[model samples]
Target: MQDVISKLVKVQELEMRATKVSASDAEVIKALRKGIPDPILAHYDRLRIRGKKGVAIIRNQVCTSCHMGVAIGTIVTLKQGKDIQLCGSCGRYLHLPPEPASETAVAMLPAKPKRKKRAAVRVPDAS
Candidate 1:
């Protein structure tokens, strides 16, 4: 379900970019819309009419569009990608980005040693 949503989001973004370049691109947008499920597409159109994004990324268990935290159970379900999940607060589709390979590799690197602070020296005063 999430995969379908991802593809639809990509198509929508492409259509938006295409329309900005040439009016002839309207045909391409129409073709892209045909591939999406009618219900999902209709929902997306409704959201657009309401001036909100149809899809939103989930980061740190929070919905990026609404800036509201999602419950842990819902986050787990979204990560599993078993079903379509919508943000309770803003009603936008939720997607979790895959963690980068470099991040895990960097985490395994050795930590830098801490340096000790030098003690302050005091000058003796002449009597």
Candidate 2:
């Protein structure tokens, strides 16, 4: 499953590159497409045709494309690499980015302070 997702991501990147220049990556993109299933490729093509990304990266348990929180079950399935996951909001395929090497390294970093919310002032009504 992860392999399929990786291929999809690569295909997307290659296609994006192809758009910026000549069809130099045509062969590579074709080969990558062969590895992906037809139904999956068809769905990806539908999204791409609409100028939307076919695959979305999952960061902090959220779909980057849709900015919507991903369901826990979806995340679990993605982590297990047992099946493909899709963002419920945007319908794009989801891939979990690789985690940082060490949690301690991240924990040792300083945390950013949260901004305080400003209270709204009531406006006086004009007589």
Candidate 3:
């Protein structure tokens, strides 16, 4: 959540810098009000089981990242919004990026994560 807000502030700052928008105190307040809470998710459905460092991973029905089934207590915490939690698995970052603006904010944008693997894969496979 804090990360999302910080990113938004950076974006706003960049925009102001790019243009000559001298943000006023009132405008600043408005921008703060518009501060992003969940930059990737609009609603609370953004919760996802992602593995992270420190926590134990579950296997089988466990987390893909952690390889452990999330505990009941942790599950409760995830749904209840106690605090930022990580998966017991792979330690990769969890949570979804804030939901983009439905109609206007983003349009004709690619929905795929770009990768530099093409060049890497182009190399002949070492037998």
Candidate 4:
């Protein structure tokens, strides 16, 4: 994960350079590098996954990880954290985590259920 972030930082730096090459970009890169001094390269790196040329393993709604149609539930689950839960639909590893709670999210929560009292059942009077 750290490796991926580090690589992303590097790529962002390169992009920034291609655009204008400013000290701000350098600072951003430096900060990210400092935070992640050592990067552990993931065995399933992008290069290994797509190969040198890079292939569009997934597009549209298909999940490259699972090679299946990602369920709506799976998509919602991935919105939470840095690492998302593997899809129930497929076993392939998922990258996105559940998304952080937002204002709308808080609002979306179901309202608390009101406690209901059970009325005592009267047995019919025996003659």
Candidate 5:
């Protein structure tokens, strides 16, 4: 699962780079494509043909490509890395980026104490 997604991402990157420069990376793209399953590669090619990204990142449980909210089940599946998940809205492959190590460490730390509110002071009224 993860392996396939990683390869797909790499292929996408290479293709993007290839488009920018005159030099071609056909060999590398060909090699990466060989690792992916035919059906998956076909779908990816189809999306590319339409001038869209084949792989999309899932951020804050939303599809970055289509800017649509993704289902919780799909997020869970992506996190589990048990299988490939696609965005229902755009039909693009969904990949949940791994949490940063600092974030995980921060989450484990105890929360800071909240500040207390000050009581209002009373003032004498002039007659």
Candidate 6:
């Protein structure tokens, strides 16, 4: 799935770069389309009809195209790049770029600060 999306994005970039879609570009697209499942290809077609990008990068846990926050669990899966994941908000395909090891380590090192307990005060009897 990831491979298909990458190829599709590359095709899109090529199309954007050239004023007209060349024969080679069409062949690349055709080959890539052949490998993608019909359902997903249909979904991609629908998204294009709606004037939305078919592939969106997951940055800061947000869909770059839709500018919507993605679910934490979905982000986790995307980070691993094991399976194809869709944005919960706009249903656009999601991709996660590799992060540096230092950044990953820093992200994992932070622990939530504990809340301080409030001191209890005895109030004078107001009876």
> lDDT of each model, Cα atoms only?
0.66, 0.79, 0.38, 0.41, 0.78, 0.68
On lDDT, the stronger of 1 and 6 is 6
Instruction: Count the clashes in each prediction.
Output: 0, 0, 22, 8, 0, 0
User: Candidate 3 clash total?
Assistant: 22
Best by TM-score: 2
Taking the tens digit of each residue's C-alpha lDDT, what string does model 5 give over 5-116? Answer: 9899989988876556333577878888999999999999999999999999987767899787776666666667899987777889987788875533333344433223
What are the per-residue Cα lDDT tens digits for candidate 4 across 4-118? Answer: 4434436443443455657776776556545542422232233335432111122333566435555444444444334333333433334442234442443344443322332
Please give the distance, in angstroms, between residue 3's alpha carbon in candidate 5 and its true position after superposition. 0.8
TM-scores for the candidates: 0.64, 0.76, 0.26, 0.29, 0.74, 0.71
> What is the model-wide C-alpha lDDT for candidate 3?
0.38
- Model 2 over residues 1-127: C-alpha lDDT tens digits? 8889999999898887645634657777888899999999999999999999999998876789978767766776776789997777788999887788652333334443322332235768888
Candidate 3 wrongly placed segments (more than 4 Å): 1-61, 93-127
User: Residues 11-93, candidate 6, lDDT per residue (tens digit)?
Assistant: 55665566678898888878877888888778877887776677788777677987776666666655555677877667778
Could you give the candidate ranking by lDDT, starting with the highest?
A: 2, 5, 6, 1, 4, 3
Q: Which is better, 1 or 5, measured by lDDT? A: 5
1 or 4, which is superior by TM-score?
1
Q: Which stretches of candidate 4 lie over 4 Å from their true place?
A: 1-20, 40-77, 82-127
Give the local distance difference test score of model 2: 0.79
Runs off by more than 4 Å, candidate 6: 15-19, 105-127
Per-prediction RMSD in angstroms? 14.3, 8.6, 15.3, 16.2, 13.0, 10.2
Which residue pairs collide, candidate 4? 78-97, 79-98, 79-99, 80-97, 80-98, 80-99, 81-97, 81-98
Residue pairs clashing, model 6: none
Superposing every Cα of model 5 onto the true structure, what RMSD results?
13.0
